[model samples]
Structures are given as structure tokens and as C-alpha cells.
Target: MRPIQNGITDAEVVFTNPQLNQWVAPMNGNSRIRKREGTNQNAGGCRLAVDSAGHKLDHIIFQGGEDVAVSEGKHVIDVTNGYLYGNMMLGRMGLEADEGFCDNVADYGTLSTYAVNTTDIKLLYYWRALYTGINRANLLLRSIDNPDVSISQLERNHVKGQALFLRGYFYFLLVNKFGGVPLLLTPSQSSSNDAMQQPRATTKEIYVQVLSDMEQAAGLVKDIRSVESAGRVNKSAVYGVLARVCLYMAGYPLKDVTKYADAASWAKKVIDLNYHKLASSYRQVFINYAQDLYNAEESILEVEFYGNGTGVYNTTGGAVGIVSGIRYFNTAGSYGYSSGFVRPTQWLYDLYETGDLRRDWAIPPYRYVGEVITN
Candidate 1:
């Protein structure tokens, strides 16, 4: 008989630590898989990870999820069959045989079909994940708000700031990806699906809401002198992401050029804080960290992932991973996920003018991955 003293679940009991109730509700809520057709299916969010195979299909099939196709019919689309057609495969048309995926237009020429992949759940995943963190922080703030708990005003404010910033961060992430997402706050204390699946909000409206929440968060955390401020949503992190939101607004469908000054100002604030810098050795930012992620420096803010040790998701993606050779062909000795599958385009490789250094480090070509280039 496990303790359910505060309505904590049995599984929670197993996961609880004597030192910390790490797996309990709010701070750590329940996310057991609900059986589907005798098999369990986790929802598409934090507890639910985006499937890469799905993205691979999305990249290959559709006209382009967040990108466009360069070649005409009977190319990779026709060659791969209509399997390489339709957003049903996750904007299957999104694949271009190059890096930065949709970052450029030149790589649009000779994209051969690689296996299915997925990463763009990005907006939904970050929103869901960080909001989960916010919920945890909120639960702590609210429950500990009694005479019994006696949390100090500053302590309360700290958690409140964390929660508020996380909420802001989550919303910013969502609006970027899905265009607009239903904002969900106030953790449900009740066991119900009653609150899920709310209608979407407008991009302008969500952007406004995000700004409002961030203002509250920025005001709440007065000084940024602590460990939490460094890693998590400290004032600087908030400003950094705020810049991103503004930049995105200016660039894409929004095309609000007026937002540029705000973006530049936010970037300036990050510089003013002296919290981080544009690493002296660019490779050091990614290289040292790939060996042991804790050693990484460039990541001003990052969601830490533990080695599931299941050998799943066991590939370096953003900087190190290769997609083409490994994820699709299951090519042996691939260094990283990006190393395995995603290819760096010749055009991108051309961006460097003689000795810029960035172009070489980034578009280093799949042929350079150690001694594995057998062809």
C-alpha cells in the first residue's frame, strides 16, 4: 500500500524521492500512456515526442511544410512515387536535400528522397513541455501559499517569475510554429479531459498575450543574480526569445517591419546584460558540448535531455548529427543524427568567402565524417 496522503498516484510513489517529490503532480504530473487498440499512445507534446519517420514523410511528400520544392515533376516526387507528395506526410513537400532545411532556396535542386523524419512538432512540443514546467512551478507557488508552507515573499516571487516567464516562453514558441495555439493556464486539479482541445487564437492576439505575460515576468524578477537566472528563463533569456518573436513577426507571414526595432533592442539588452557572448571559438560552442552536453557554452538556454540509454534519440542532430546516411540508409559509423541523414548543400557551402570559418565548420560535407566515407 503506497502512500496517497495527498492524492498522489501509486506510480508517483515509485518515482518519488525521499529528498524530493520529483514525480508528484504539478511539479511533475502524471503522463501514463492510455491504451489505444490495446497499445498505448502518448499525445503529441512533451510526454509525446514527434516521430522522425513522420517528419521524413512530411519532408518528402508534401509541397513543403515550411519550405518549397525546386525541381519539377518526375524528380524525387515522381521518382519516389506520390509517396513523396502531400502534406499528409508532414508537409512531405518540406524536404530539400540540404541543411537549414528551409533556410535557403538554392538546395532545392537535387533533393533525393531520404526516409521520413520529424522535428517541426517544435512549436507544439516546446509549448507543451515548458508549460508543463510552468504548471509545476505554478502548482508549487499556489500550494505553498498557505500559513502551513510559509514560503517567503521573495521565494514566492521567484517561482512566480519562473512560472510567468515559462508561460510566456511557451506561448512564444507555440505562436511561432502553429501560427496560433489555444493558451492553457491554471493546471487542472480535476481528473478530466474537460479542459483540453480549446479553440485556436489569432496570431496577433497570441502575440499580444505573450507580450503581456512576459511583461509580468520581467517585472517580477527584479535582479538576475542566481543559478536559475543563468540556465532557465532569467531576464536575459526572456529578452533573447522576445527578440526572436519580434524577428519572426517581421520576417514571415506577418511582415510587420515595425517590429524590427524591438527585435534589435531586445538583442541589445542581451548584449548589455553581459550574461553571454558570441563565443570566441565558434566550434567550441558545439564541439566541446557534443562530447558531454554539460560542457556546452553556446546554448544560452536549453532543455536538458538525459540519456534515455535506450539507444533511442541517441544522435547529435543540430550541430553534429547527419540525417541522410544514418537515419535513412542506416549507414554505419555515422557521427550524429545530422551526420547520419541531413546533407549540407553545396550552395550553403559556397556562402563562405575564402576564410569566414563558419561556412567550413557548418557545411563540412558528409564526406568528412571521420574515416566512414567509403565511396
Candidate 2:
């Protein structure tokens, strides 16, 4: 796993592969990496190279393919997986059933005060899930100087931008949910007591880090659609997320009114990019999604899902559709299992303007219609 000490010289790591075939082969397996630095770009740009520190960035990037490629491309493969895992954690946190037909016994218990009991183990589980994402991103950043894996400055910048975005995003979630939290910059490579006993940082400090990371990422990432894989984060998504983060920082607990202008500025940048536009028909978006067709032009960022006939919880499986999909019975063309746990409040349904397409699209006429009906 450690590339620099494996009796491999930096020059051998970078230029020894005359054909540069070793690097391209592993990168080609990962769509995003292939697109970023594939053979087509410079006849073999994906070849791994080392930095001045005798570290091999290529070795770090190669650590993650399916069966694992040569020593060089393994690490790059798992980076995408880390982002996917973080998305799932975000999805889980927003699953509180109080929103409407969804009913979770635990949600009911916690809704009254908008608080969780300290004794509730689920809180710890959720916290750890988010931190796991943070740790993965941190480790990637930590290894940027591994003289064993050879990577160019451009490649390093792109990877660092992504790592920062993910780390900031995880911290944003932590601060919003639990207030002040320990701000661990270095990766916890071991389970030593020193790693576990860090003190909490103020919410302001966390917000500063979040803004700093997002701001840097916005400048470093390329627009995603131009690349082969839209699944990965891009400059536009970074701006969009920055807008939302600014909004969060501006509201309620933080009350940093000045950030209102910052939020607006970031959002305007996304709009100015014109990379995505509103779909003419909202329902078409979901229809396309169910059919495994994604509209990158209209959806700047999307969390992808693959549905099986039966619902299962796994990295590749998504239950949000089932959790919030039409409950009680299945709809022939629907994307979910109709778990019937979450429902919309009638007040919310009625609040929409009569001609607004989203109102009905959001809360359909049929409240529950599969072998059962409840008022």
C-alpha cells in the first residue's frame, strides 16, 4: 500500500513504462479517471508519475479497481466509492418521517421536541457514518505527497479539490446536525486514544473550513458534463453546493446575514454557467431516471440509483424512492416499492398554486391505493 518504500524509484515510477500502458490500463477501468487523464488526451497521460518527495501519486490513484490493477491505479478507484457512500449517509439523515404519510416509530418519538435522546445509539451510528466519509477524503488528501505514486500538478490539484469538497461537505452536515464537533484535519490511520479524544471546534471554525474548502474546489474542478462521467463532482456542482452552504450559514443558529449576499453570488455563478436548465416537465425527469436515462444538461448534479424488483439496502441499492414512493401498493411505472411509510401533509398539497405542475407531481391525487385505503 505504501508506494515510496517498495524499492521503487520515482523515475522508474513515472517514466519506466515507455508505452505508459500500465497507467492507462487501470485508469481506463474507472470512467471518471479515464476521462480525466486517459490515453486520448496526450497519448498516455494516465501513466503514473512521482513528485519531488519521492512519492508516487500514481500508486495512490491505482489502489481501487475491481480485482485491483497493478500497484499504481488501486487508490484512485475507491475515491468514487467514498463519494457514493457519503451521498448515502446524507440520504439517511433526511429520512425523518415527520414530513408527511411516512411514519417511523422513532421519528414519532423524536419529532415533538426536534431532539434525540442522548441514550439513542442511532445518533452515534449516524455520526460515525458521516465521519467515515470525512476520514476517507482526508486520507486521500494526506497521501498527496506519497513519493511512490507519480501524479502531475494538474492531477494533484483536481484530486485535492475533490477531497476538500467532500471533507467540507461532511463537516457541514456534522455542524448542522450536531452543532460544534471535533475538527480533525489529519486522517486517523490508527485507533489510538489520541485519535479518539480530540476536542470540539466552534461552529464558526467549522464553517470557516467549509467555506474555504468549497471556495477552493470551485476554482479547481472542471465542469462535469464536459467530462465522461457526470456522476463525479464538478465546478458547477461545487458552486451550487457552496450556495446552499452559505444559505445555511446565514440562517438561524449562525445568523451571519452578510452570507446572504455570498449565497446569492454563488447561486448566480451556477446560473451564469448555464450548464443546466429547468426541465419543461418535472415528471419527465423522473420518467427518464426510472429508465436509466439521465439528462445532464438539465440536472447539474444527481444521486443515481438502480432499482431491483425488491428493495434492498446496499451501496448500489437505493431505498429513498421506496421509502417516499407511492405507498400501500405498487404503481406499474413507478420507480419504488411503495413502502407507504412517508406521506405529504394535506396542507402542503393544498398550498400549491392551481396551475403549478410541481404541486401534483409532488403529492399525487392518490394518497394510498394498493389493496388498502386510509384517511
Candidate 3:
């Protein structure tokens, strides 16, 4: 067994094909890579490159699929155990229990259906890969040195700084999901020798560490050439992540409440940084319908995952569902779908503001798959 690095221990490491990191999911076996350079559209376009000074990243993880040929194309093949869920981001598949799909609901976002199921092995894979990045971050922060390779002093500092930022990043992920896990700052042994099933730390402690890491990352990448080429980490990315972490910490985890102000501040950083911006259209953020590779301005520090790489997957089935509007399907004045799983909830329908584009397209008659449904 390998030693535990970061708060992650030996038992935590599931040694599979390293390729799994690229694409592992319902569509894993056939995933491919689409490499592209990061660019700056905010200014005269410039390429952001992480010079050799910082430690070399595994580069495998960040190489997530960027090609329409790789991601949107149909050639993707499933290689990992067929979990059938897209490892990419959230989606709106179907809820067999607890929650039911509503006709009035927008086209996507169904993760809450399976959100309560702690038994999801796929969830574990997602978390483990996330922590692996943390482990790498820890190792690099200590030093990017390998007896087999040589490097200049300046490059070493650059790499170390990026590691510090990433270490903070991984911890933030763990804390968000688990609600305060042990702060694993250093490498660990198989026994977790000094740290055995360590108790969950306070959310405050995690927040402190996350803040520290972001600040450190900000300083390290301050002078890097371009936003896209800064390798895996950067200043604006840290700020955006910091804003999100602060939002969670200040809210549900710690009840500090004041953090929202800071959250607002951090969010403002990316908005004002001249680096990133919200896309005019919300849907494009998920699917790469555009030709430009880096949705750089809209996406700050996106986790790279190819369509069907080892441990890599996407949201196709998740994307499949019935979407209707008031203009389309309606019996009298109700909403429903041709689909069995998709039925609208009163709350979802009521939540809409008047004149919203989606409301006019409502599917109605309140019909379930096998029976005539009612509001």
C-alpha cells in the first residue's frame, strides 16, 4: 500500500489504471483528450503559461477533454465500471424516489434526486480524485524535487506556490461535502500512524486553512504570464474559489454569516479582474457549443474531465429529459410531460417570475406516463 499524502491515507488510494483519471464513468473506455491553450480576451489576447519554475503537475487531471470532437462528439466510449453518470458536473436526469421531476422545472439540474444516497460509489470516486489533487498539492509545496530531475531555484518557488493553492483547494472540497474533515497538511503513512480515523475538525479550522491557501496562491501566481497558461492554478481562480468557500463557510458550516460580505468581495474580484465574466447565455457554460476552447472568462479554474476517459465521464443521459412550456403542451391549464419521470411541482411553477421565457413554453394537461395527472 502507498503512504497517505495529505489527510488522505493509504486505504483511501484505489490504484486503477492512471488513465482512469482522464475519463472514468458510463463513457470511460472511449474518452479522448483535447488540448488547448488558455487565452486572455479581456486585454490584448495573451497566453497564460506556467513556466517550469513551479513543480510539474501530473498534467493528466487538468488535461480533461476540451474538444467538441472529444466531448460533444459521439465517438466517446465507456471504459470505467458503468456507473452511467457524467463525472463532469451536475445534471437533471430523473429521481426514482424522494423528489420527482416537475414539468414546469427548467431543462436540467436533477442531482438532488440522488443527493441523499450516501452509498454512491461514484461519489467516492469523485471525492478521491479531488483529494488526489490535494495530495499532489501537498507534495509539490514541500518541494517539486525528484532525484531524477534538475530545476532552477525560481521555478521551484513558482511550483511550490501553486501547490499551496491546490492544497487549500482540495481541503475546501472535502470540507464542503463532509462538513469538516481532519486537516491533513502533511503526507501520511499507511497506518495513518499518528492520525487514525481522526475526528472531523471544526468548520472554522477548515475555513482558516482555505483562506490561507488562497492568499498564498494569489501571491505565487501574481506575475505569471497569462491566465490560461498558468498551468493548473492562478490568482483570479484563487479569488473565485475563495469567494465560494467563504460563502459556504460563512453560511451552513460555521454560521458566521459575515462571510457573505467577503464572498461578495471575492466574487467581485473575478468580475472586476478583467479576466472572467458570466456568459450571456447560461446553457453554454456546461456544453461547449462555441468554437473558443477556453471558456476562460466564464469558467474560472474548471476541473478538467474528458467525455469518456478513465474516471472521466459526462452528462448525456443526465441531459435527457422532457422540457415543455405553456405554449406547447396543455390540457385546460396544467403542466406535464410525455415522459414518466418528469412531472412538475407546484413550488417550481410558482417560483417563476412573470414574463420569464421558460414559463410560456410550459407542457401541460398534467399527464403522467400511464395516467392522466392533475395539479
Best by TM-score: 2
Q: Each model's TM-score, in the order given?
A: 0.57, 0.70, 0.54
Better of 1 and 3 by TM-score: 1
| lDDT by residue (tens digit), candidate 2, 1-375 | 000000100111232334322221122223322113213222123333422223222334332222211222222212222122312334444544334533655543453234668765555556665565566565556666565544555555666676688778878878988788888887553212333478889999999999998898777666665442344567777898899999998997899999999999999998888677776788887666556555667765543323233323211233444445555445453333455455576766778888998876676666555454568
Q: Flag regions of model 3 displaced more than 4 Å.
A: 1-120, 145-154, 189-196, 222-225, 229-231, 280-293, 309-346, 358-375
lDDT of 3 by residue, 234-254 (tens): 667678778888888777648
Each prediction's RMSD over C-alphas, in Å, is 16.0, 9.7, 12.2
lDDT score, candidate 3, position 92: 26
For model 1, residues 1-375, the per-residue Cα lDDT tens digits are: 000011111111111122222313221121211111222222221110111232121111122221111111110000001111101112213335343343322332232343323443422333344344334434333432344323345544544565566656656655665677666565433211322367777888778777777767666553444533233345676677778878878887778999999999988987887656565687765464444423212445543211111232333221112233223323343343333333445676676798786764555543543444555
TM-score of 2: 0.70
The lDDT, on a scale of 0 to 1, for candidate 3 is 0.42
> What is the Å distance of residue 245 in model 2 from its true position?
1.0
Q: Lowest summed lDDT over 10 consecutive residues: which window, candidate 3?
A: 1-10
Tell me the deviation in Å of residue 263 in model 1.
Answer: 2.4
Per-model C-alpha lDDT, please? Answer: 0.41, 0.53, 0.42
